[model samples]
Target: MTLHQQTTRRQFLQGTAAATAGLLVPFASRSFAFQSPNERPVFATIGLRNQGWGITNKSFKFADFAAFADVDANVLGENLEKAAQRQGKKPDGYKDYRKILDRDDIDAVMIATPDHWHTKIAVEAMLAGKDVYCEKPLTLTIDEGKLIEETVDKTGRVFQVGTMQRTESGQRFLQAVALIKNGRIGKVKKVTCGINGMQASPVIPEVKTPEGLDYDFWLGPAPKVAYRALPEMREGYGGGVPLYSNCHYSFRNWHEYSGGKLTDWGAHHVDIACWAIGASDTGPSRVTPLDYTLPVEYKEGYPVVDDQYNAATQFNIQVDMPNDIEMIITSEGDNGILFEGTEGRFFVNRGKITGKPVEDLESNPLPGGAIEEVYGGPVSENHTANFIDAMNSRKQPISDVWSHNRMLEICHLSNIAMRLGRAVNWDPAKREIVGDSQANTFLSREYRKGFEIDM
Candidate 1:
């Protein structure tokens, strides 16, 4: 029940620098402040609204709740009240998330904060010896992905990205991956991912920060802006259109905190595409944005308009994968993947999977127990449960950092290419945009002072 002192980055490296892969032994290798023979792992969540509690609700089945942190104090109090009522335990509340990371009793953390905050908290959590289940669009930029991937290796923490499409019910995405890997679609030639475009945003006036919300802390690494009250204008996707600075759910439509739909939905669809084409740890050799239209005027890849949404609304991007497979990612069609090969083609989304190969599954089906194979073993009850299993055994989760980083890197490159409105050669091994200095700059951003990730 007691919280430990925050571990300095130097202390973390000093503790872990000597540990090597040959000496590592999974769950047995790490030290925990509370690890009795049979007790469930303890967890804390940093972001307490929407997806934060949504993930914690599922995590209760696998781990005990110890603490909750949020910049917004009201949500923290509310979520803790719900935690007490649901779990019969009162969790400590933290306004700054670092306090949660300092807890030695907690074994894991769920980082459902905005995209920009994902890497900082996840890296620090692992550095403090907590396993992490970070929500999707794992990195705000390509640089963060590398940092996280390296830290996972250095710390040996079980990390899972919130890409649920990898483990959806009936194993639909697994089937797609399995079909492609098994040559069900002979020699993949092209792929099309039609995730919706960034929705339009009208001019929003800057206003006062809400009383209980910690707007500055919520902004974290993002550039600071005066808090604005965003109107609930549209329904479903891209609504609320919160200040392009720090968004509630509308962050996905902005580039400052996210990659718009490119990294929003692309994180899922493009991830599957990467898995299908066997390019999880590697990336494309070239990324060229075709016809593109930004929602706002731009110079040097930043928005000129202060209040209008700045992400591209129309884009047809061409990415050349390592395996001679070319993918066209666009903002059109039925929000799904259409895989084409020399032999045949099929389309799949959350609703259904279809085409000759999928139809052939009825007569000439995939091998017995194939879905589990694509799931990287047993089909879990859900992604959270899968992460818990990995935490116990020290195995890599289904949606892992290395692969997710590759997928995310591709998405980041697509945005950079689109913003530049030109073809950009990529050197995935180097993790750089080759040749173009301006293009290279987009690979990462300058973190606001005091909010930078301590490598």
Candidate 2:
């Protein structure tokens, strides 16, 4: 089907790029030459509940949203209806994203699925000649990281990771990196990263999966298991006790689907950590998990879950870098980063950026090319716009797979160290754990039969 021909009830529901107030307009009118009448770069999105909406909403300016895919019919069903109303067309909806990937009319895909399905779907989509925008924490494992990094280069297709911090403005997170790169921060000595560690999955007993939800597809690549209301805090489940927390947000807490808070928040926080330290291509050389005392027993709805929190609840991990740079990652304290340079130290997070030596955020002028360079040239309206631009240009997006793989590898390493309770050595060149069989197990997992990630 052609881009225009693909329009259906479901496509209209997924949204359209037609000019409208309070929303983005078509990039074609802005001088983007990639989308001709026959090549509009029709796009589809997998996982349409939360961030998926943001991606879809932003992409309306650049691509035609011809399809929407989701496992839970109830949740995405609302999104489909909204997309149709906004776009004034119908879109194809599917439970299996692979169906969407296989469409010849689709030139690209925006993936916002749970973490576990990221690498698999992205790899398949790229192989199918579709550009992809997979969510952050790009890979669930170091091996998947390597696979994605390799696959993108091999496929020679546009692929953007959802590391939107690079697109955010007036934030010291990226500014600090530019400052350090410009030698404003002097010689960097160490980086102390503070991220909340992963917590345990809920202790609730299994319950029936919700209707209109394909439980098995939702558990794609992860082992099949019964559902208990996965905790859904305002944002996501932190993998803890159940209450109003019993919804669909907490996938980050488990090793199966996500990197827990370490990766969940780490994808954002550590990404800045790497950016500020000027180590986006390479990661720290070593990860040593520092142990701390925890509750011997914790209450979960009146019964003890017995250390249900598989990931480290409290610990400090030290990562050694080349040139004598050291990264100290602490799971507690504040949620941000501390960059210690030869001359001074600076602390930055979502709320604030402060240090003994760095200039005030408002006072310091950013380098002329800082914003454009970070976004690969003048910024697109936002992260999704960047992806659409890359989709039409057939160029790499701001948060391409290689950069995100390197950043996420650090998160996976932290989890591996916390779980193994030891420091693991890494060969950055090979992208593998050095001589540690036990730790290597964390690299990639054995898929349960049909769900396996293929070479």
Candidate 3:
């Protein structure tokens, strides 16, 4: 099928960039250091819901689960039970992740909190001398990305963003990057990142906070608002969740908690595009929101209706990359990355990487070590394994924070422009949005008292 035609074939699973179960380490390929018998890296998992549970589950084979942290006491208890069943032991539990950070055994943490909490938890975890495996998007704002980068530099902790596509042992994404890097695609020109559109949430009325849930802590960093009943919390694009912890999975739909599809899937595809084009340490020169649709009435980047979701409903954004190449991120078609170079173009997603460059592998394969090289060095069994292995060896993980932040910068910039409905220039070196004061305002958000990430 043509690239455009494939967009409609699969509805695409959101956030999960790759399949987890089929991920197995090549018997000869798990790069682990020789540590003493008791030296397996111990880990804590904060945000014990969906993604949190998944990351922690995947990493347990390589690491020791020492604790569980979450605002919901019920979820925390449930996660502790799962951990006990998985590991034959249950570690400590805490409502405040800060207590987890305080523990002597938490060598690292898998931060799967909502987007608003990703930055603060990551920053403090590094400061506390704990390595971190944080799920994707990395930041709620551009400034948060910088703070995490700085913390990584100063703390020397192994910080890995959960963009597992980079370390796929199958090399689906790696092969695609290798094709572009080997100059097989000719001169790179543009990338079309067809991410899914934003979700619309219904207007929900305020209600009493659910029991066994720490609502105040759950709203950490973001503005304080009433519990908008369970309905307002769940994205209107889909049917409601059984529990009111709608912020756990549905948080991606609202700007206050996340950047909708821009940071959601864009974090995965845009990141691969950056890696392919050799721009992971920098970002686009300009970001322009060519067109957009908002779910509710918008004014000054926020929706007038407080009860409904505010993130963009749909958008076509154009970004000018470093080498005069263009990037088109749209919510119109498929959820995948299409790389177009001078010689040819190709498409890749969770399913398959296809096109001429990929087909060329039949006769003229990638240079012997191209896949390994694209993966930085030797690939890990999985994204979490990379972080745990890196913790012992002190090397950057496959999806290291620096490059993830660079890719995250692109995601944040895309959201900024879409929110403003205009073009904004970005200075990657200085890491600032230029000229427009209002546009620059988006580089950071005001935090709730005592919730700021100390840079």
Report the lDDT tens digits of candidate 3 across residue range 1-455.
Answer: 12221221211111212323322112124544424436456788999787788888987767778888999888888889999999999989989899988876567789988889999999898888788889988889888888888888898877888888887636577777878898988999999999988657666567777688888899999988877656333344323343332355667777899988889888989989999999988888898999988888778977787777677888999999989899999998878899998999988888877787777777776666565677666556678766765665677788888888888888888878877778889999988988889988888889999787654
**Local distance difference test scores for all models:** 0.79, 0.69, 0.78
The local distance difference test score of model 1 is 0.79
Tell me the TM-score of each prediction against the true structure. Answer: 0.89, 0.83, 0.89
Clashing pairs in 3: 200-236, 201-236
Better of 1 and 3 by TM-score: 3
Top candidate by TM-score: 3
For residue 154, what is the lDDT in candidate 1? 93
Q: Write the per-residue lDDT of candidate 1 for residues 1-455, one digit (tens) a residue.
A: 11321211111000112212211111111122223323566789989778898889977766678899998887889899999988898899999989888767787899999898998899998888888999999998888888898899899888999998886544577778888888988999999998888667777678777678888899989898776556445455433334343367766777888888899889999999999888888899999898888888888877877676778898899999977899999997888999999999999887778788888876777775555566665566668867766775678899999999999888899888878778999998898988899988887789899898765
Residue 429 CA error for candidate 1 (Å)?
A: 1.6
lDDT of 1 at 332: 78
Residue 285 CA displacement from its true place in model 1, Å = 1.1
The order by descending TM-score is 3, 1, 2
- Candidate that beats the other on lDDT, 1 or 3, i.e. the better one: 1
Q: Report the alpha-carbon TM-score of model 2 versus the true structure.
A: 0.83
Better of 1 and 2 by lDDT: 1
Q: Candidate 3 has what TM-score?
A: 0.89
- Which residue segments of model 2 deviate by more than 4 Å? 1-40, 169-171, 197-202, 230-247, 292-309, 356-367, 373-376
lDDT of 3 at 380: 65
